[model samples]
Target: MSAQFIEKYRENAEIYTGSDICKQKSKELLLEINMPNGLLPMDDIEEVGYNRSTGFVWLTQKKPIQHRFTKIGKQVSYDTHVTAFVENRKMKKLHGVKAKEILIWITLNEICIDDPSSGKITFGTPTGISRIYPISAFEVEEDEKK
Candidate 1:
């Protein structure tokens, strides 16, 4: 059932990139990134994009996007973007000071496998594969007007 919710990326014609997948571990990863220490309940997530040429996959949540008030009373929400992994916490250093607490930047590490025939996706089974970093923020101007 979970597999039905995932988006498929076709590599050639017969093989799917298998970037977006619906699995327990993938859900947990999204939940951990969304909330640290499991403080907030995990919401459903769906994959956004997969670059078959570069082997990159982007993720997003299925739940309603939440917005917050700015210091100037304007309502805005964070736009998340995942970048390549760096060991020295590059993302945190660059954005840690400006990013909000709810906005988390994390270096994701995992080996994903795609089943061309069955359309099943699999990731490495290790707890520490994904790590959380600081949150990055960019206000949506359109949202602020609404």
Candidate 2:
């Protein structure tokens, strides 16, 4: 995200820097919002910021990354900077994230779980197209040692 954008929401935002803290904070934010912590598997995180009042969150990493969710046989690419407006079980206006379709990469703009009991999550694109997948596909198992 641009410095100007960050500055606009800096006030009253919970900001964390460094890889360890950023990673932990990001996961915690996801869990708090009723989303899968593993939805974002970026490493070398440089910063993370959350504005609770506006439900805005941003994360920055050392470099862009492409991760394949083996269980779902899908590949997702995350840019160095990602931003979104998140609320309980939903993330909207997402930026810097893309998913590989059969032969093309589609930008994902929204993700949500309308009903947790459905055990399904929906990913939508800017074109109004969407796909549903089992929520378990995005969950990350906690380390037993932790």
Candidate 3:
């Protein structure tokens, strides 16, 4: 993220540094917001920040990475910096994330579980395109320390 962007949101935000802490914090935030913990799967996270009052969250990593959700057969790319405004069951105004659709990469702007009971989750794009998939498709097993 740009220095100005970080400065504007860093005030009063809960910030955590280090890969381990950042990874844990990211998973915790996702669970708190009713999203799947495996949705991110970012590697080597350097920092994580969350501003409760504004519902803004940001994550910084050493480098960009692309991960494939094997269960769902989809590939998604995450940038070095990712930011979003999160709320219960929803994340909006997201930046720095994209999902590959066939041969094209679609920028994802929103993700929400409209009704938990429906067992569905929706991924939306800025251009009004969206796809709903079974929530189980994104569920992942937590890492077990060896």
**Total clashing residue pairs per candidate?**
3, 0, 0
Candidate 1, pairs of clashing residues: 103-135, 104-135, 105-134
Per residue, candidate 2 scores C-alpha lDDT tens digits across 82-130 of 9999999999999989999999999999999999999999999999999
- Pairs of residues at least 3 apart in sequence or in different chains that clash in candidate 3: none
lDDT per model vs. reference: 0.28, 0.92, 0.92
User: What global local distance difference test value does model 3 have?
Assistant: 0.92
Model 1 agreement with the true structure over 63-111: per-residue lDDT tens digits: 4333443433323222332222211112111111112234552322332
For residues 1-146, write the lDDT of model 3, one tens digit per residue: 45468679999999999999999899999999999888889979999999999999999999999999887899999999899999999999999899999999999999999999999999999999999988888877876635
For candidate 2, give the lDDT of residue 32.
Answer: 98
Scored by lDDT, model 1 comes in at 0.28
Could you tell me the lDDT of residue 132 within candidate 1?
A: 26
Measured by C-alpha RMSD in angstroms, how accurate is candidate 2?
A: 1.2
Error of 2 at 53 (Å): 0.9
What value of lDDT does candidate 2 attain over all alpha carbons? 0.92
Flag clash pairs in model 2: none
Return the lDDT, model 3, position 134.
88
Quantify how close model 1 is to the true structure by its C-alpha RMSD in Å: 15.6
